[model samples]
Target: MQFVNSKAFAQGLDETDPLRSFRSQFFFPKVRPDAEYLYLCGNSLGLQPRSTRTMINEELDDWAKYGVEGHVEAKRPWIAYHENLTKMMAKIVGAKPHEVVCMNSLTVNLHLMMVSFYRPEGKRRQILIEAGAFPSDQYAVASQVRFHGFDPNTDILELAPREGEDTLRTEDILSYINEHGEKVALIMLGGVNYLSGQAYDMVAITKKGHEKGCTVGFDLAHAAGNITLELHDWNVDFAVWCTYKYLNSGPGGVAAAFVHERNLDKDLPRFEGWWGHNKERRFKMEAEFDPIPFSVEAWQLSTPPIFLLASLRASLKLFDQAGMKSIRAKSKTLTSYLEFLVEDTFGSRDWIITPRAPSERGAQLSFRIPKDGHGVLEALRNRGVICDFREPNIIRAAPAPLYNSYPPVPA
Candidate 1:
């Protein structure tokens, strides 16, 4: 597709965009009196959907009216509330409905998945991860390795890009696994590196890990709604993600986990609670933990948070309506336009750290602006172009397809 450096070209893209109407469905932030900002920070926190308040208020009204009875009497039935999101969530992550469950926060779900999948035996006791992964993932993997009486410095192997490259090559990763996979018990990596905005080839990585008898999982915080996933078809062992970023759930919204069906019936070690027990005899208060068979619900820790679930439901309805295929299609074009404009206007593409191939990235484009990058960030903010700057020297701009558009309008 030929791209032109003009406002009219952008307007043409917007006019032909099927997802254009979705922009009006969200509430954008204002930088000054009556001036709505061009919000490109969806990779940090999404814009609130117009329906979120009403969805949440309905639950509040239910509590006010039914009191304790709202557990079963509410419009969504709080007793089985989390179940309401299972099907839609599964579709987004490309897994079977029974394989996905919305429960604890992202880090908490990571810990749970590690507990079940990160078993270290003699000699094969090391964990493999990307060098500059999200700090939370690094911390979780380090803590888990230490909990099992191993030194994190030695047991956790970090994979880094070639000295001159800003992003990793798939061949390098596959070669690393082939050479050192025997000693690695668990391979955990971010589906999309938060800093470079490079999306990993999950299918190939998962296959390589399994060939070496290692378990593989992903932290999809940046990949969930930003890229197309097929966890089931790829045979990924386990994965976890938060809903707030591109999913358009509000800040601190609910997170989710996915366990492959092959692991569901296995007697894996998991920290269990009552909500995981058999639903038929749950109220009977049986002492034995009879986990729900053939379902990821066995990992549930406590009762569902109805308000948060309501908020998630509101955003997910839009996802269900748009479909991941359509969202991803728009995302590719929208992000490419952003790249074109950045390079065309700025006169150079050398600062971009994200992969040039659309298949190797998502909606975000991270720039390595070394000199006074924060000044650039502040300037952009003052101009009402809302983007985020990462530590050391990177600025991230993510044009979300759900509510973000291509035209040269007020964002």
Candidate 2:
């Protein structure tokens, strides 16, 4: 697709876009009294859906009317609230309904997942992870290794990119797994690197790790709604993601997790709680923990957070209406157009560190700043381009397919 740096081209893309109506469904920040911000920060925090307020109000009203009884009497019924989101949420992450569950936050879920999957044993107690794995993941894996009486320095292998590259190559990752796979207890990675916006091949990595007798998992915070995932088919041992970023579930919203059907019945070590016990016997106050049948729900820690779940449902319904296939189609075009415009505008002044191949990235394009780049972020903000900037020197702009738009230029 040949892209031109003209408003006409941008307008043409928007005019033909089937998901165009979704932009109006979200609330954008104001650049001026009459203009809207160019909000490309969905990779950080998504813009709130217009329907979110109404959704929350529904739960509020139920609580007001039924009080404690609302647990069973609310319009949606609070007792089994997480059930409403099960199927739709499962579809978004590409998992069987039983394999997916919405519970806890991202880091908390990561900790819980590690409890069950990261079983370190005699020579093979090492954990293999990306060099610049998100700080939380690094901390979680390191601490887990330490908890199991292993020294992180010797037991945790950080796979770095080759000599001069900014991101890890698939070959490098696979090669490492082939060489030291036996010693590795777990292979963990952020499905999409938050900094580089590089999307890893989860399927290939999971296959190789299992063959090497290592458990595999992913932190899909940036990848969940931004990319197409087939976690169940890919045979990912487990995966977790937050809804706030690409899922458009407001700030610090509830998170989702996936546990493959194959691993469901295994007597894995997990931190258990009553919520994970069998639903039929939940009220019986059973001292023994009988986990919900063959599903990730067995890992649940507490009762669902209904208000946040309502906000997430509002977003997931939109996802259901506009399927992932269609969303992905527009994302590719939008990012490509933004890439063309960035190159055309900035020329050789700034560098785009994200991979040129669409398959290797999502909707985000990160630019490497030459010097004091913080000012560029303020300038972009002042001009209404709501993108995100990082500490070292990178600005990430994600043109979310659900709401981002290239407005028509004035005559």
Per-candidate Cα RMSD to the true structure, in Å, reads: 1.0, 1.5
lDDT of 2 by residue, 1-411 (tens): 888889787888889999999988998887677888888899999999999999999999999999999999999999799999999989888999999999999999999999999998889999888888889899998899989998999999998888988888998889889999999999999999999999998888998999999999999999999999999889999999999999999888999899999999999999998889899999999788889989899899898999999999999999999999999989998898889887888785238889988999999998898887899998888777888898699999899999987653211
Q: Looking at model 2, report the run of 10 residues with the lowest lDDT sum.
A: 402-411
lDDT of 1: 0.93
Cα RMSD of predicted structure 2: 1.5
How badly does each model clash, as a count of residue pairs?
0, 0
lDDT value, residue 137 of candidate 1: 97
lDDT of each: 0.93, 0.90
What local lDDT score does residue 78 receive in model 1, on the 0 to 100 scale?
A: 92
lDDT of 2 at 406: 62
